[model samples]
Target: MSSQRRSYESGHKPKCLVVVDDTAEWDRAVYYASRWAVRVGGGVVMLRVIEIPDQNQQWLGVADVMRAEAIDIAEQALDRASGRANGVAGITPERVIREGDTIAQIRKAIEADVDITTLVLAASDGPDGPGPIVTAMVRHLGSFPVPVVVVASSLTDDDIDALT
Candidate 1:
């Protein structure tokens, strides 16, 4: 609920919140976040978001099953991402799974964790245009709660290593 960040507090370390959406370039975000954590002595928190469409209440049972399935997929994706972060920087990232609107969930996560000081995202470099999240985020540029770092997907691991 607080707008103020606690990352600089006496006992807290800054953390980067990386969304582990199943994008082709998500690895770039993870790589940057993990490396930054190590270089700055902070931490990495990987988040997987599952979006469910509004449906009839009559399908409550179906919704439960769908939610369960989504959670499983989210876990698998986070596992692979977590492993990649560990492999890249020898650090295991904190994993978070949330369901609902992507931006809303991301905001909630940041609000709940005061130490999360930055959001690391990867931009789509293909002809399809910058990724969905990136497009949606344009609306919140200045009003966003935390600073966002959008890494270009075209950047190779070596390129990111040099930058981070």
Candidate 2:
């Protein structure tokens, strides 16, 4: 086990599960998770789920192509997330890429793999903003095993200046 994982096992600190989607919104969750991890001497798991299209006998080739694309996208997203987290101090995070239903996969990772003491999620901007994805995540949160933290996006510079 890694030193970070060992720390979690020893109950020396908390473990955070961060669900990473291919969107700028995830930055909010990552930032919050990193901040909390440092404050509590905890570790983070950045999980990216690449949904595989349903396989059909006649569409094996198409499915293969889609799977490859999904893998590529997930890898890129994970790499960027890792880099961003690394740039921050005292926020070492582990990266994981898996296939299946995003919510189900994330839940399973938290339950069976990650020793998650908290679940940090980026809040969806709503129906006029991001649609079904936000709904699905909200629905799943009700049954999540660990405590869930939702981080809303920060205001833009223009918006902040306007308030003043």
Candidate 3:
């Protein structure tokens, strides 16, 4: 929590933060966020975080290469997500790429931007259950910086439109 939100006050507008982690159900979240932005006259923020693995001394030189690769992938993911959001609501979303724990990065993004009032995520339909982030989010839902909206993987565009 970072001070009182200034959303809908003059220059500031409410925003929905959507994670674009290249997950199988990422589109669901983006769609929901885009629709929400259009309906409520809010904005959208898309975030992609890179979770880099630790490397040994022998792999010192490879760290740079790995980081470069991760950044490139992050850019591509954000591009696709941005395209989808634009197609849905004709709104260009603010894209952010951070390197670290997903949940921590999300918190940083929200703290960095006061207008972001909601987090939208899509559940994975795997037999194991919803994806890790969504599962983890369930446990911390009560203390998360903002309200979260979880979209089911099975939802169609029409289903989302009707709900939003």
- Best of the candidates, TM-score: 1
CA RMSD (A), model 3? 1.3
Per TM-score, what order, best first? 1, 3, 2
Best by lDDT: 1
Q: Report the lDDT tens digits of candidate 3 across residue range 51-118.
A: 88889989977987999999999999999999999999999999999989899898999889989999
Could you give candidate 1's per-residue lDDT for residues 1-164 as a string of tens digits? 45689898899999999999978999999999999999999999999999877769999888889889999999999999999999999999999999899999999999989999999999999999889999899898788999999999999999999999
Clashes (candidate 2): 0
For model 1, name the residue pairs that clash.
Answer: none
Angstrom error at residue 33, model 2: 0.6
Q: What lDDT would each prediction earn against the true structure?
A: 0.93, 0.71, 0.92
| Model 2 spans with C-alpha error above 4 angstroms | 1-13, 124-133, 155-164
The window of 10 residues in a row where model 2 has the poorest summed lDDT is: 155-164
> lDDT tens digits, residues 29-148, model 2?
777777667767777899998888688889999999998998888888888887777775345588888899888887777766546787777765754564344557777666667777
Model 3 ranges with Cα > 4 A deviation: 56-58
